[model samples]
Target: MPILRRFQSRVKFFKASEYMQPKAEVQNLKHMRTSHLVEPNLVGKHTLHACKRLVERILTHKEEKAYKVGIVGTGGVGKTTLAQKIYNAENLKGAFSNQAWICVSRDYSDITLLKELLRNFGVHHEQGETLGELSSKLAAVVWGKSFFRVLDDVWEPEVWTNVLRTPLHAAAAGVILVTTRHDAVAHATGVEDPHQVDSMSAEVGWELLWKSMNISDERDVEDLRNIGLDIIRKCGGLPLAIKVTARVLATKDKTDNAWRKFINRSAWSVGNLPTELRGALYLSYDDLPHHLKQCFLYCALYPEDSTMSRDDLVMLWVAEGFIEEQHGQLLEETAEEYYYELIHRNLLQPDGIYFDHMRCKMHDLLRQLACYLSREEASQIILEN
Candidate 1:
């Protein structure tokens, strides 16, 4: 029943497996309008277009046939971004009678997802309904209607085959767009030709770095070009890594000495990241001001893909004494400033679905790093349900 389970030993913790899924009470959510899924200003425009082409080729469905397509990539490689672009494409307007965007976290609950799907279809299920009842309600809603669904951040194929596929297939015609970190998940979910999102090239990576920092001066470009490329190389062409590193650079003085000092930071050389995303993630955490570090790491306690409201985070930080008292500021105000700072540093991402400053989410990889660091700091920080 724990969202995150721990081994009997005090030090080791693991997320709840899909089978022993956590229970989530369904809220009566308003229909998810495509207008609400605001697309972030993305880098690598060419990749977006290419991904769109792939989706179109597979899902165009001139005869209203059902299609299952996937956009697969490593964490932070922009799979979600591509899916958003496709979801908002002008040409695809009016092609489906209804659409829904669901964020399927690592430990998804079948009943919760079924309820969410019905919510997106503008249907409300009665309390105490069985899985059979929820499925029937979902099937009724999609029956003979054209549907489009975006299942974002899916972890396992069973979430599709065992939970969603049956009811959704009742549509007159439908297209299921799945975004995942594993190609196996895509294929298992019926995405026969999942599109693999490649890492950014050196040129695009530098362009993204410069754009993120608003660095356009010809002399500045020349000054930082070599060091910037080296930084990008360490990033391994991951957009998330490049952007996080850019935030760290943006806060430093734009001088060769200052830039060199940053590039030579010791964290870059060592630290275990999922793969090539090594130092950039650690550097982002390391560069955080001491006060913000605790606040940022505390976020790792939440489940992956979890959204936290700004007020709630600020209050939590205040309760835990993570916020320093400013001479003329309320603790809440200081805590709020910390929240915005994390967002500025790209340590926290704005929850796109809500489209407001009130809520934000931590990237999964960042959360993992935070959890790892938290465990290292206080061996007694035991995770339980």
Candidate 2:
């Protein structure tokens, strides 16, 4: 009886331990799911192909230097879209045991940024550490592991040299991919000839438009088709512009008059449309708030892609009679407010924001959009030109 009682107690103890084990395991899984996670989505075929080739090169050559792949193009040209696709590809998931995607916006703080990167690597450090110490912690975490790090929408080389590259270099076989709108940025990063992505083909553009419009058959309306082609041409092969216009057209019933109206409205701007990129950027410009509209249009006074000094731009704004002075606010301060507003809207890219922060010039597409709006708003000025 005593032996039997002991046996029964042992069985009860084992049963309790088994029941609690699953609960603890489930809680651990939930914790893991909530922490240091990345979710990826499909981009398109062309982008996926490019990504696969890059991953293969990285995996095949352990001794070879890590490749720095860059995607460069005008804004809204789908650089990020393509980069995301490559990052999320299922086949390439095993290439790197540890990967992180960091979006370096204009407002990235160095220490905070390092913490985010380390968190992805499953390294936890106390919050109030110095930038140097945080970088050291990050370096230690990535030391042995092969890392795939993507710095998306990089606007400055200083950020790369000072903050990201130092620690990232410690990781063996680490691949860094950058996406940007500027050629000089790629050059500054020492990438051997960044890949410049051009606008989609007209056929692809049309297909994208159809997808956006949710239209199945182009054959039902021949006249509409002709007008649509003309509109697509006006867009300058920009996917964004094509899709926006298609959405606009799609909402209206299929009719020759409706198609003609769109064509005619877009027709008068003929040669004014930017030649470098089809006018997909125009829609974004047209949607700007009034204050930003004035600020962007004011950029036309400067040369194309010419970097402009922040103080000089403000002084110019004061001299050109655009900004009105208010009590307790200098004209320079008012001008800066507008500059930041434009930057926030993705209308302006920061040149450098140090002791003497100087902002460079706008992209050709943005300049063109500004010019288009300026002409449309002040037709008399355009007519004189």
Candidate 3:
């Protein structure tokens, strides 16, 4: 009995030691499954090409100066998808010693949130410390190291300037990638010219729709293919709209009349569809003070994809009596100032050339959002016109 008891005690001691081992060392052994990593499903050649460019840039400058890559486009335009694909690509993964993916959601400035990012990088804090302490600890871990950090869905530029840039400044030769829907935010990052992710082409959009549908039928294949192409055209080459519409169509029985109806609906029109990219714009529109909403709605008078001269847009607003003139500033100049404010808020995009510099244009998606809000406010305008 005494000999058996001694052997049992030895076995229990070994088990406790094993359990107490550092988690970081055992992470691979315990989790070894690649399934644990959230791999983004990125489709289309455009996305793949962007990823290749990013990887090449990072490699080319790995030993030189730090590189920051900004992937900018409308929401649901596949910015995050492209960034993730590049981050997880086998070649890129092997090139960096440490890789961290952080999501900078709408409200990303909370210190606790920043600490969570550091934790993902395998840095832990002592109990009862503030975020500043944690930030310093993270700096120590990342500083002077070759690291790959991806800030996904970044909304506010200040968040990047304050939280990310500070720590990143310490990490020599590290690469930072930011994905944002706002060009102003990209500009604020002080990174090189952003790689813009535009909507997919018609061919690519149709291919994506086909994949998303998972359609397979010999008799109906021809009809379905035609419907898919038509539907893709209505999607304005936006991948999100294409995928969502395709999924919606897939559940319905395939029929010529049904497909035709789907293609003809104004709701599917590129200028009318409610897009995921427009959701943020809608929120901003909704939050606008009543007077501002009216002022913004007056912008729809401009043509789609057409450049609205800052002077012209403002003058129209003033002429239509949208702006209240103040002393010292000319009414046209005041109106231009208001237009600039809207530009700063991302309510309008630069049309590539203004009175010399670039002027402003609303994206099709944003224009649609503005029109929808306008219609909701004064249904009579759209109904009568």
Best by TM-score: 1
The TM-score, computed over Cα atoms with residue i paired to residue i, of candidate 2 is 0.59
In the predicted model 2, the residue pairs found to clash are 235-278, 235-279, 236-278, 307-360, 307-361
Scored by lDDT, the top model is 1
Q: Can you write out model 2's per-residue Cα lDDT over 134-218, one digit (the tens) per residue? A: 8888888878778777777778876678887788777777777788889898778766667776777665666666565666675
Residue range 137-235, candidate 3, lDDT tens digits: 777777777777787767788776776666656776677788888988888876678999998887788777766666656556666777767766666
| TM-score, prediction 1 | 0.88
Model 2 lDDT, full chain set: 0.61
Off by over 4 Å in 2: 1-49, 61-66, 218-224, 266-385
Ranking by TM-score: 1, 2, 3
The candidate, 1 or 3, that scores higher on TM-score is 1
Each model's C-alpha lDDT? Answer: 0.76, 0.61, 0.61
Worst 10 contiguous positions by lDDT, candidate 1 = 1-10
The residue ranges of model 3 lying beyond 4 angstroms of the native Cα positions read 1-42, 126-128, 217-221, 265-385
Q: Write the per-residue lDDT of candidate 1 for residues 101-206, one digit (tens) a residue.
A: 8888686778888988887888887887998889888888888898778888889999989988788778788888888999999998888878889888887888
Clashing pairs in 3: 351-359, 351-360, 353-358, 353-359, 354-357, 354-358, 354-359
